[model samples]
Target: MLIQKSGHIIVNNSTNIYEEGSIFIYWEGFIYGFNQQSGKKTIREFFKNLQIHGFCSAISKLHGSFVLVLANEEKQEILVASDASGQMPIYKNQDMISSSLIELTERTDLNKEDLSLDKAVEFVLTGFQFGPKVLFDAIEQIPPSKIVSVKKRNFFLINRDKEDDPFLRTVKHDSISEYLNQWEILANAIRKEKVSIDLTGGTDSRILVAILNHLGCSFETAISGQPTHPDVIISSEIAKHLNSHEHFTSIHKVDEDTLISDLYEIAKNSKGINDFVGMHRLFQLHKERAKRGISLALGGGAGELYKDAKQWRCALLSCNSKNRLVDKLVNTGFVGWGMGSQTPDQLFQTEIREKSANYKKDTKKFLKDIFPEYHKCDVFRLADEIFYKYIIAAPRGFSPLMFPHYSPLLDAAFVHYGINLPKHLRFGHQFYREIIAVLDTKQEIASLPTTRLGMTLLPKRIIPEVLTSVFLNLQKRKTTISLNDPNLYSLLRKRLKRSNILKELVGIGLLNPKIAIDNIPNKNLGRLVSLWLFLRILDKRKN
Candidate 1:
């Protein structure tokens, strides 16, 4: 058996090996096999002219995320094949070792002298890395669906293409009744699995629990929040109603001193910037569940499933004025005022101009594909791009953790179904208002049971307006913006003033510099507010 680059490979001369995450090597006299699971058939038969017989035929028939290496150790020749998706990476460096050193050298580093930092930065900013580039210069991913073989020092490329016979899109249902029937199919899928769900007091997760209960699935529910947050209360109620064991944790008052330590641990373990405090708690939760023998955890991710993108589409349909769409976009939460008050049109233009050449190309193609009727609008283009990349991918990445994370809402089947449904059916006439209504209906899941306890911090709602006002005021500008009502402004101001650490960090300019530079009085002043607040909690924990 040979293990290379975090995968298992076995050389067998006596038997036929069949297993997932396992590799089989056929060699002289006997067949050897390695598998993560136990008691698999190792060798089945022997035949003369084995290389020309069923050996190659059987090898070609195997399908999975794996690599196969066939060798006639007596004849001293080898062939290697990889699966279609290349979900399991396989790489070989030729002439780096002799027969005597083959056992010692499990993997070889790739030369990355041509690695591009600019491309890396652009990819990271877009929220996903692409192609074969790894963080390490010496590493490269094996491209999906490729076959490579090595015999002595010579290498051969056998197959390189996407999987043929792509899965067909299934859309047999036409009405809400049919959609409900499809939902039944999905609920049954969840019921058949040993599953746990991250149940926030939100419409999405609540709907999932309701469906699970209807399907007669025995599931466990987990919630994260401050003790008194509305979500905790609602999730607890739903869990009790469903008769599912409920686990709730208070994160609002998490020890400040421990936050930094945990952050460091998270940084070491995580792959991307999108990971934040919530993930750390999730990791701990997974461990606890694993100890109790749970294997699958479900959550309602993919904001599109619950939040209505159809709002933008509806606004586009009813209103011919671009300005109206812009206003509606902001009110509907399409434009992130927190990021900046750039109008939707302006944000669209900036992103189109600045993002990757590939992204621009893809956006142009997507615009044509999704909105063929309308002349190209920067607003629609931008919304579609951001919706798919940042908004959709963030929660999807959670699926790859050590434990399987299942989100039926994000399931391709469900998303495609929702996309084709009429806007009225999905979110009703006034989109955002309708969404809030839908959310309120599932209020049992939407309320948090407790407030996050820590150094008092500005309420999330007022930060944008306060920052905008502070910036405008410092510039000697008087703007009558009714957006920040007095009561909310005063509450946020008190929270800001009370957190000396946050104030100091914000003064230094760290949390989100671009936001600080544009909104704060002093550009560099808010450097470490979020980080410092996070670290201070960690420090207190140690003390």
Candidate 2:
């Protein structure tokens, strides 16, 4: 990594005291830093132990998705910690550790002049980059279940064995009552706070509504994006059936003219690889929350960690045969190996293809490191990587900046409960429905079909011929609201021509000028444009 910035570790600053009492200890995410109970644990008692035991200890013992920062005046040092799932990332520059990766931009020099080879390959194939590696190489991301310390000119890590608690070495199943007990405990915390939910027709939020209702809490709900979306219609009905106030449902339409400029700006700042059109509109909803004084909202985040789609990804990876892996990838139209397909592997250039192919070994190794217990369960492990990378990591970037949201499933108690529980019940949301059924609250969540599958929670695969016809019809609708809008491709082509990235890639022999722009679609165009924007935005050091 290039260390070109002059940032001294301040050992002590008497002036750093009391701004908010002239001191600022910046930490984000929901923290259960205290463990007060009949154990008679005081918040001070908790901190005293935390200062001695290290940062991640609180999370292991208390369990929630949070980032904790502990600054010790006595030690003249700072400890930064992220939760077990690494839900909130902490970025480190030569000088400081921060929650935001944008901090790295202030440095004039970077460790890498181009994208990391492994990341480039992975992003092109998978639509997102690997963890602990941001869009920039100079800025390093501190992985989850870690405590990092910066003292004077010294930097180091404080690793605890308890960080591995969520990955529980042995597989065991917790009962339905246990899961509900955990949910009930979490729900009780904000029962008096008038909780607000982005209630959807989906199981995650619906289950949350059921729990909050059973607790007799004051709760309201909202939905955003298309008014006609099944989630919107279903969620509105759910709120009515529960007899709770409906907060709002955003029906704001986006302007196509904005995609060429403002959309790129949003994508760049978001620093996400896979998020396309509707996901980016989370920015607009942020403003809505602030106007409504909705301080805390709830959503179902890690629900997919055990869903059928997740299991499917696992089952494919667990094939343990390269030919089978390649065959599955080809059949699903996911990895276009071109085994007689019209434009097999034509999406990315040959060099990119080869680079991606080579990284599969490294990628498999990476997954193993994250999940060492998954000898026969690589599927669950791989699904977890997807959940963590896209579901938890990408979206949480919007929060601590936009609005704060939580999922009960993300809590450490719930995570441990589900992971240890029978695998079959967890992902299909069969267990989720069981909890609601037991709650004796509204039956809507249990009886209603999810907006995601349109048919219900567990959807049956339609015949390929019928599916193809339906997809083609949907594909023809041509919604301009997409980041993948064909018109945006023209804009991206122009943007590429003006940018120095392609020339730089050519200089590095990473680009083949002849085939760089061949057979690209709106999604591919969007990814390329976003990558180009990342290079520019990071290069220009734009905040």
Candidate 3:
């Protein structure tokens, strides 16, 4: 399912290629792809017909993810193309042959080196690599919606200018009524086999469920954590109200035994430790769903599309208010929950100021690159543009995991609708209020669920007062209890001595210098200690 070239690998399901479906073929000293459509018979036939001298094109018009490579035998050249939105990864190194010749040997017969250390660090910092850069230095991933050609060792890249094409049509809508009408377009976009909904007691998921229900689509719902967990209880209630079947699961503490057994397997398979915790749980859940023959799953993964817009409105309000907005924001959430004795007002201020400064700088650059003509737009407009470019589009990486995973909210139509809404309609607490209203009007919720498992099953009174104290301190600063806290350091050291989990955390913390430095005594060593213990478990498994 995975093929590697020059340290980059492509994943695909080639064994079962349906007629009129997409297929990845490794042939003629290169990779080739054929997409079956109205006029095309086989991919090979298409390639054969388009036999231009000293050049070959690997056209990938399929709906799924793949890398298409075309090599001209006479010219000894190769051309590659990848799907739009970067669903597939295609990497190349211009110096691969030379590098391989120098480094390749019997012990290391592989033709390429792993991702570069600097690139990998950058990925850790940014979450994803931008442009042609990968986690490796010499190797470069081909950008999505692009073609890379090599003719007699001369390289040329051509990007599909979707934004510049005048012939491409644009859909225009008027007022909220037209926007609401587009819901049908969104509903029709949901195409999958054995669909399941990751239902939550929230508005986004509720709206999706209602829409799907209206369309007469059949779907089962799945919820995670104990019955006491807020999402679980709320989702279960919603499912019941909707008269739908549901599956629920619980996740307790990730203990030493589980970490030790599963860490290495996960790391080896995934190739990195970023988001290791969440990914582990997701993988388990995905496997479980896969067993039931569910190839496609839907969730409120893009719920943030609407919710975050509302948050931005609040942020803007705080920015304009005489009263410090940070204080108000901090007080409203879990950040206000007291955990430590430390006064974090100054730290919080500094962090927010730094972030604001960074945001402004980045927004300026983004505007210059993406909307040079819109130079006259105000900060608010620029902010909206940045949001669409960064946050809304950033999570596409998580989408392909569905394989055939389909997210109604993330669908093209839904996103277009969500993005073009008037600023007045897009911002403010009313955004969420409207969604909640829709849920209630649609009767998308069942009953309220209980609290988290740890909170409900574990006696709150018995829980260490220090933990609460630490949390309070973090809340005061609008931050989490970090490893640098003395209390957390002492706790982790004690845990390390007594628990294998703590030992493993220490090991991983040591390996990742950033993790170690971030938890250095000044920041919050206690929190670092806890994270280190987690990392230790991860490290042990990786080894």
Q: Which candidate tops lDDT? A: 2
lDDT of 2 by residue, 1-543 (tens): 111123232312232122122222434545442434211232344456655785455436554445555556566666666666666566775566665554454442442354565565455444555567765566677766567776765667777455354654455466767666666656555543435687777767777777777767677787776666676778877777675566677774555556556655565545234433324456566557768776566777766654444334534465664334333434443332111222223444566666644455454455446544445544555444434433355323454444446666765556666555565565445566567667744455555656544434322222342355347556774223322223445655655656665555444444455655535554545554555555556556643
Q: Count the backbone clashes (under 3 Å) in each candidate.
A: 51, 14, 43
- Give per-residue CA lDDT, model 1, range 1-543, as digits (tens): 332322333442244343222223532211112211211232222222233454443433233223455554454445554433232234343332111111212233211222233333222233333444433344334443345455554655654332211112343436545545555554544434456788765456765665566556677888654555556666676676565555554343334445545545543333222233334455555656677677567777653533334434635553555445544544443432122222111111233323433443343344345434334544443343334432343211332334455555554345445444454543321222233234344433323221111101122223443355447546765423221112322333344455464444333322222232224321112212223332333334334
lDDT of each: 0.40, 0.53, 0.41
| Arranged by lDDT, best first | 2, 3, 1
TM-score, cand. 1? 0.49
Score candidate 2 by lDDT: 0.53
Per-residue CA lDDT of model 3 for 59-98, tens digit only, reads 4222233344544445555556543433344544553211
Instruction: Kindly report which residue stretches of model 1 are placed more than 4 angstroms away from their true locations once superposed.
Output: 1-172, 175-194, 250-253, 268-278, 310-391, 394-401, 429-543
lDDT for residue 218 in candidate 2, whole number 0-100: 70
RMSD of 2: 6.7
Global lDDT of model 3: 0.41
| Worst 10-residue lDDT window, candidate 1 | 450-459
- Count of clashing pairs, candidate 2: 14
